[model samples]
Target: MSLGAEETHHGSLKPHDSLFRDAEKVSHSTHRGSQVSWMQTLSLAFQSIGIIYGDIGTSPLYVYSSTFPDGIKNNDDLLGVLSLILYTLVLIPMFKYVFIVLYANDNGDGGTFALYSLISRYAKIRMIPDQSAEDAAVSNYHIEAPNSQLARAQWVKQKLESSNVAKIMLFTLTILGTSMVIGDGSLTPAISVLSAVSGIREKAPSLTQSQVVLISVAVLFVLFSVQRFGTDKVGYTFAPVISVWFMMIAGIGMYNLVIHDIGVLRAFNPMYIVQYFARKGKDGWVSLGGIVLCVTGTEGMFADLGHFNIRAVQISFNGILFPSVALCYIGQAAYLTKFPENVADTFYKSIPAPLFWPTFIIAILAAIIASQAMLSGAFAILSKAQSLGCMPRVRVIHTSHKYEGQVYIPEVNLVMGLASIIVTVAFKTTNDIGNAYGICVVTTFSITTHLMTVVMLLIWKKHVIFIMMFYVVFGSVEVIYLSSILSKFTQGGYLPLAFALVVMSLMVTWHYVQVKRYWYELDHIVHIDEMTALLENNDVRRIPGVGLLYTELVQGIPPIFPRLINKIPLVHSIFMFMSIKHLPISRVVPEERFLFGRVGRKEHRMFRCVARYGYSDTLEDPKEFAAFLVDRLKMFIQEDSEVTAQNEPAERDNSSKEVPEAQARLTQTTVEEEKQLIDREVQRGMVYLMGEANVTAKAKSSVLKKIVVNYVYTFLRKNLTEGHKALAIPKDQLLKVGITYEI
Candidate 1:
């Protein structure tokens, strides 16, 4: 547990120091202020309707049409399909996500990576060893539990951490889940918009299929073009449109029930679902691929939890969205019972003659909003993966100053927009797009089910029986839906899998190289004692200005630093080893962001600073960071002086005791002198020194490893954003030391 004299001096203070206690009080109050008021929660809930429910809300437009691709068999078939839709909406989105999975979030952030982060914090299953002791002290990194309650969780954690296979399997599941979500991001917009645009033919019978496809493509272009405005503006603008769309669907559904057969309400009974499958055995199973579309955006509810709180998402879904969607489905079934032939266009046909055009316009608008949910979720998952070092560094723009989680990645948006347009042009029909979209949704859901089971046993500390029940019920439903969709792999269903495999491969390759590079650095780290000896050599000369060597190592001098000194024999008068660490939480408070310590001793003029950030925190400009580091360095000097004075031995004789005024004056002068020295070095200039590592496979490695390292990883490194660029470091003041690694 000991980190030597360097860490002992800088990382802690004397028990009697009032300054340390006061800082702790401020950090606690800042965290307490983060809780939202009930009124604010309601406001957020209203906005969440536009951002979170868009995909699932628009499902009624094509559910019946997609479900009965070959046309409705009979009146009983209509009731059976409706029953299946009703229970799917209840079990998946309602009981499973809103009640269970949402609670597993890592400090309010959601999705597959967030769940993985939460589990990793409670155990040591993380594949990389980048975490330091200082990281565990973050305000939100909670891993506390009574021994009696944590027995099972501890056992599970030990098993996972002890076995390399288990660790890789867990990480693979997390990455695969993320890939599927990104696939959903592309597929949702295609299916949702195409289904809505298909309604145009109902009013204008002269329109050809190609014309409809072109119109859909144009709408998609406009949708992605406005994404730079950020989620707050988009949510505010789209909320009213979506709110009206939900009300219109619910009203039209009730109208259909009153005018058509109300007896279709009997589909609410679970018996109808059983009977539907019993009458048409193989055909009923295949219909599930279509019926699952009712809950297409269910994963979005959890994935988008980062933009809003759990309460807001829960309220929006259960209070408004859940009832409206259920009613819309039942109304469509009622109309189909009377006019079985109209099942091909149930949503548009069920509308009354006078309200048809207005309803049609709102459905189109609502469909665009639905695509936003998954697109936003896609950005969130990618951001999390990049922070955890599982993805290549890309440009991440923090779109909202007020909301930390609202982000926009231009590269991802551009690629996603193009991919979606291509799919719309190629498939060109709702049924074909539906085949691709269903698989992505169910595969993501199944991955979440498995991850959540581990979370229940470990983080949540639930009983084994509860875990089994959760897995069996949810797992069984997802497996059945997955099988039905996999059967259609030859017919458009392969699209998501193809997309997921490419994405998953990139993630795995990037993560593998990063881990190897980290081990290379760790193995060659220079100890404090060795660094001190190097400084004492006559060939080395200490220069006047400050040097901040950027590294990933927190505990010792990076190997590149020693190499720099040996090659050029020049060192800074004041040197700082700087490292930036991204924790699994959502945000780290400014007061707790930096941990500073002396490298060897006060006379060595060397220091170490570990800057910790939450995944959601933005990196400040390099100049601003330099100024902040100077201020913290000054503060550390004063605190260290105070601690030294307290630890000094008392005078044995009364006559030998120092005067109170003289002692106080002496202490103040010493602290001021040290502060001024640091300020003078700052005025001279500060330079950022970083290492440029070239990674390749070992000479005797396998052919596959060589391809991954020499080709795939090198290409990614050259094309993606570098570490310094991502941190906004100025080129003129930056210095790069080259290091080659054959891993």
Candidate 2:
């Protein structure tokens, strides 16, 4: 086992060399401190109002009309519905999300993946099995494991990590939440834009329903077309228009409260909520579906947490969005009580005649802004999904280098735009669009509540009594809304569910097949000992330069290499097996990005480099990656030398004073020689070898599985961004080794 039989070796340092006793220390720290003036903080809060609160702020346009579609029965009905709206606005968005859920962010990143990251760190319920200790060291994965000394904490962690069922359940729950958000992405644009433009019919009564649809479609086309410029440009433009819209609504509401029925303010009492529910019974229960719209974009409070700090989002919501929306809803109720027949188009009709056209113009702009936020949200969710391995890899373009979350996916943008047009044309009314919107919104809310409860029990380790109390309060309210939305399934409610099912099916199939394919490669991977013998065969020609063989196997040599050797009968002078893994954490520190080690033995001239990344990390360019690998390979060589020296015996006497000097000279000489060798080897350039795997099910597999694997998953795989392109690998130096397998 010489590294190269013809090449002479530098004298090897024996064990007990004082200079090579310890390995290099690699320390990781996740803390970062910065100072910001209040002026800067205030600027961010203003921007956050424009970006984070758009969807929720625009809810006033349709909530009242959606609730009383058939028109208000009497003043008491208006009062009751207004009371429900007032309390819901207070309970969910203003209280729970602003004060509580925003605090549960993963290193300032939020959404389903953030919660999953938090929970996975404390327990062993990570669905992906290839996770490493280095992966857990990512900044966002900074949560410490539960203390084993506590019996109850240990029991919960064991239960969550030990059971296969728990892993699947947690993964499924996250997928459902994400899928519903995607559904909202599609529904929100259609409903928001259509409702906005529909205001035109009040002024121009001659305009047909088809005309309104065409106008909405045109608006959406413009919105989606400009998405490539990214939200950083559009977000600032939207905030001022939305701020003015909120002020207009608030001012109009106050005017109507004085001029029409100031007594409608009595709806602020909780007793009306109870009396209304008791009087109307099932009718009032059913209207909960519409009332839920008041908190339509509440999830954005949690979903968009990555874009801003908790304090900024809360300030935007509490200081601006909450009061304006509440006043607008109450003003609509006041106007409706004075003229009960206007309930069908309460938002538009309730406006004072003098300011109707101006308000209508602002409403359209606000709706467009709301749709923009949802579209951006959908892209973010898809990007995170791809990183988590739940979805196929898509082309993700970062619109702003300064903000990691400001991304745009061209494919998703096109799909959402098309879905919006189809829904707007088919539904022809906000009444139907609202039906679909309520279902998606309530379903997502329920899913978040469930995930939060699990967080409280497992990660937060709250007392069972407090956990149950949370469930009884928020969970019970969400369930009621869910029931109400379920009743409208035949109307437009089926739309979001259908969208969710399609997206969920795609994600589930891709993940299942990917896990299976990975396991198959693992079970059949080639061990280094077998490959070493193949390398020594006289029939095989050893070529110059480095071969960077890329594979998914984190530990062993890929089977593709021996297969490649069998065909070509040639090997490179240096072989480095590389694997890039995306962890479920939000971000990985640059210092801990690469993990280097020997393949088997040093004389083999083979090494392994694992380039680990978190979901939020941007991959380095190809040239940078090559340089990084070479640098880390040098470190690995040094660490290996240190470990070997500590294991072997020393040549000099232990008591000799000159022994330290002698060891230092030997260590420096050996390191210099090794560095020269590495420099020479690398001068010949590097080639990247990657496998193009074709996967299919076995003949004995079930028809459903075969269809899923060979058809659905294959389709997705073919359409996604290719590995080399995504990695920014140079085309000239790239080599593809194709392999086919039946799972």
Candidate 3:
């Protein structure tokens, strides 16, 4: 009774007017040929500049001013900062991310979880055990076969799987990375907007600091207010603005190079980096905290890969972003060499006097677009986390059905908006926000290096020397940046660390409770034979309608079944034990998404269906899923008859026809009776059954266990959206059975 190839059309049969109607026609381009049309390539690259590169592109707004807050002291200091900025940009974002990290993309999706998905396929490190063998056929579940290096890879896999400490360390590192990404959603808007609006001071030197903060806060208010409208609209509106911004800044840079001191170009040599560091000494080391801002939004390159293709993103970066940003930085340095007094206002002062007003207007627009990218990335991370069961369920609105990744979580949007406003008002300057921003940026980069090394060993199967070389090179670079940022802990650098700790706690607690709940059901699992024997007694009355019982267990009968029968006297005539599971992949194909089987013989009228989805798959309402299941059940009966007919022998056709005629009569009678029962039951309606558990620590447990389980986990469970609401179950047809559990 499997819903494999035969039930492929069920998704299209959904109502055309449904909110997620476009999800039926999922735009799966993975299987298409490598060669895309020129128009598609161009459009994708253009949109990539708007969505993928906004944060990095806007880095020029604040990097220079932050590096020399008290103003550029000498030519040595200026050239040194420029050299560090140039090499940092070249090493981290350009060489590391562009050439190497992008290759580690998971089935075209990229992020911490995407890397985790790739690593989990070859190791036993995953916490959730819901995935079944049939899940391997999902379109995105890809892993290369073990080859000549199989022995070495297997050894590493065995060591990692058997060790509890290693498993916990890996999980902690991955969650901390994801939490920092969410923290970026709060900090990017604050710094980018404030830096752009700071240009107002150049024109009106009389404007007080409070006036600047007020204007920046007002712009942030408008930015977050329109977030509910979603990024599809925002992307289209900002693409042209960003395109113009790049061209405008590059033009200003070329003019500045020809007009101001051209000797600033000497900073391109690595010698200046050595000379600058040697000259500035300790001050040069401390300033790496600010210089790292040159590559602030580099993570967006990997995080936003789900929205656009790799080739398109690469083209956008190489062809447009790289040259434009380089020219802008060089042009600012040239202006500084001529008028050292203008270091505090490098961007606007460097601009040709006639074009300052136009560039200022464009800078504000570009900054707003940059904030949108971070906000969208945060939503994507949380949505994926929820699917993996690490985060509690929240309302996920798919703003654009054409792209499954374009989502909006209203609760997240409100909180992020409020946080950004608080940061803008409280910090009141990009210098301090830059400190907090540098901490998050460097920490995320370091985590990426660690995860990427794991991918190299498990998935890529690189040689030992190659892995060692990678770790030595990238690991040292990230460590230095991290040390520099941590040195400023007292000056607004503690904010991102505080945010990450809070988010990590919530994720850890929710995951702990979910894993505990699954173990409890496994320990108390029952068998369907118990229910069959009770029916044979003929002591219990059978009700009419169908019953859909949800459970966490994939095999055997869930403990709740017996608990329900004990509490209630009767059961529905036809029953389905259903379980929904998420696999470690990006998207699951429809034909292989449902696994159906009978709980017993045909006479039992009981069945089991497991609905499977990938981490990035769109979830359907429970009512829709139920309708599809029933249609598949009807198809199963017909398919069974076809199989029986085909197996009949040709030599005994005459005799076989007679037997089949009688058998068919009996089968027809049984099917007709079942259909009549189903029709009559439909008039009475169906009901959904679920259990609501109250979890607390065992009596013998220590105080720490009580606080974690009975306090923290319990509070999250109650505060978060309930399972029924998340599944979109109809209230009139829902029944919640309550129970208590001690862990």
Candidate 4:
């Protein structure tokens, strides 16, 4: 059976009073959207142009120049390349992405991790065993299919879950895809800004390459520096700039078509693409490395979908962005047909004399917008990775209260900005940067295609024949593009590959150590019986006030609690084992935030509380969290008393005996009495008890494991944000206990 089906059956069999069931009543709702008003959709569509289409929109500035770096041999070559560009834009971005891939979003979040999250919900394919039945219920994970399709999905799930190699392969592909996008985060700014700035030399021939590079770097600095203002502000500001840019390009394209070769429109025929490849032979095939640049920002379209709705992205791309970009390419092709020798500067040369200056300025602005899209996408994917435990904790600032998906990561911005500047300075020309940029773009595309193929079978439950067709049609095209780019690896293409390697390594290492640490804690968890025995000991005194013990475990006492008791021989009069879990959805509702259950006997005064949050949910401060916890605890106690009172008469009749005074007192406890007791504990104040695990490799481990765990994981954990700080726990009320683990 599929993972969701299995979980549903298991959950149905659970007792009504099961803790997981209690949490289910308050679980976060599904991320499905209601129908949007047309006006709001249009506004979002307008904003999407600046954030979603910027990278691909700016492609016309460099595609022709990059494609024919050796200069066009004839009009056939121009028409042929134009045909290739047209088909790629239509097939990949329009059909494959806009229509197909966007629908695969995990609760409105996109990108590779989002895809993985969706699949993991349907299958037990995640390597980490942190997911629970409660998580599935809250995440709104489900599927409805005919028996035939359901069997196919179940088969896919069983095969994936059974094979460790398959799971690793899937995760590795996701990490690789994410790494490439982050790599693109730096490369996009470098190429887009440099290409835009290089246009200055067309009118001002005296400007040196160094001067252009300096100017581009300066623009990049300003663009990234302003990211802290968030996507809402940036989108509003950039929408007008990009909208004007599209209009200008479309207007100029029409003017060029009228004045030059209107026949260039015939390049839309697929026959030209075949003919171009046949005539140019190997050279034409290799030119794909340049031709693929037309869809550079296509991944950004899906990646940034979280910033807006899928409908808005579709409206923006199809209604305004696609037609303008296509016309711009056609116009450039027409210009190149007349002046084949001007292939090196087709974008600028094609511009009419009067509109040249204005187009140049807009190109620079649009280029910055393109970079902004990729940078924002990078921040988004990294945030998802961290929440899933694949990446180290980084400070994630949710910029828009209305749009939780819109975020800014200060560390990521600074790193990408510096990387962009370094690359612009080093490459010194758009030609070299284009080589590197094309690899990052196509590699990401190929990864997405592969992941989507799996989604079609396991999640979409498509018939095998249709699934094969989707893969063959899209995968074949991406493979051709991938080959062309890999051929140019030595020609600066290695830049992104090297960067991806570093990033992927960091992510893989971090995930590995985190899983180990979790397993260690799970193996050592303190059972309720053990906890009850420990509390009954005379030496272990229950001190006054409440203590919130933080742990990764969702059930039972944390291993650290027993260790703390052993070391100090003291416990709080009222203690809570608090586990914070990040679900794989976008946001958890505040009403369903905390799941409370008694840990043991009534007089033990101990409880287990799980604070569940979605990936995009913001954590509350310590004081607010304490208030919510106390309020929830009081309700839980009063409900427990009511249940006990109802059962007491049944027990009296069955046994023909009087209840003990202690038992009667517990059953008779009123809501007001419970409230007063909780308030009294609250007035005494709460302490946040957290554990700091120091991990090291066992002596028997291999050299590689030792190096990875001891050095890499240690360095990352030490540098990244601590759990307490990320959760906004107050330092004064926090007590951290250190525990050493050999893994």
Each candidate's TM vs. the true structure?
A: 0.94, 0.92, 0.91, 0.93
Among the numbered candidates, top lDDT falls to: 1
Candidate number with greatest TM-score: 1
Assess each prediction's global lDDT (C-alpha) against the native: 0.82, 0.78, 0.79, 0.81
Number of clashing pairs per prediction, in order: 2, 1, 0, 0
What does candidate 4's lDDT look like per residue over 1-743, in tens digits? Answer: 01111111111211224344444566444333336678888888887887778889999988988898888878888889999999999999999999999988766777888788777777777766767665555534453443357777888899999999988988999999988888899999899988898899988999998999999889988888888988675456788999999999998888888889999988988999889988999999889999999999898878777667778888898999889999999988888888999888788888999999999989988888888778878887787777778887777888877666668988788878888899999989888889999988888888888889888888788889988988899989889998998888888889999999999899999999988988887787666668778898999998888988898876656678888998888888788888787776666666556666666766677777778886656778677888887887776676656555665655444454455555667556555665787688878878899888899999999999999999999998898888787778888999989898899
* Per-model RMSD to reference: 3.0, 4.6, 5.3, 4.0
Q: Alpha-carbon error at 627 in model 1, in Å?
A: 2.7
Between the candidate structures 1 and 2, which one is better when assessed by lDDT? 1
Order candidates by lDDT, high to low. Answer: 1, 4, 3, 2
- The RMSD (Cα, Å) of candidate 2 is 4.6
What are the runs in model 2 whose C-alpha is more than 4 Å off? 1-38, 144-149, 655-663, 676-683
Worst 10 residues of 4 by lDDT: 1-10
lDDT of 2: 0.78
Badly placed stretches (over 4 Å) of model 1 are 1-23, 26-37, 143-148, 645-655, 659-668
| CA displacement after TM-score superposition, residue 681 of candidate 1 (Å) | 1.7
Model 3 lDDT per residue over 73-146, tens place: 89767777777788888899888888888877766788888888777766878776665555544556666643
- TM-score between model 3 and native: 0.91
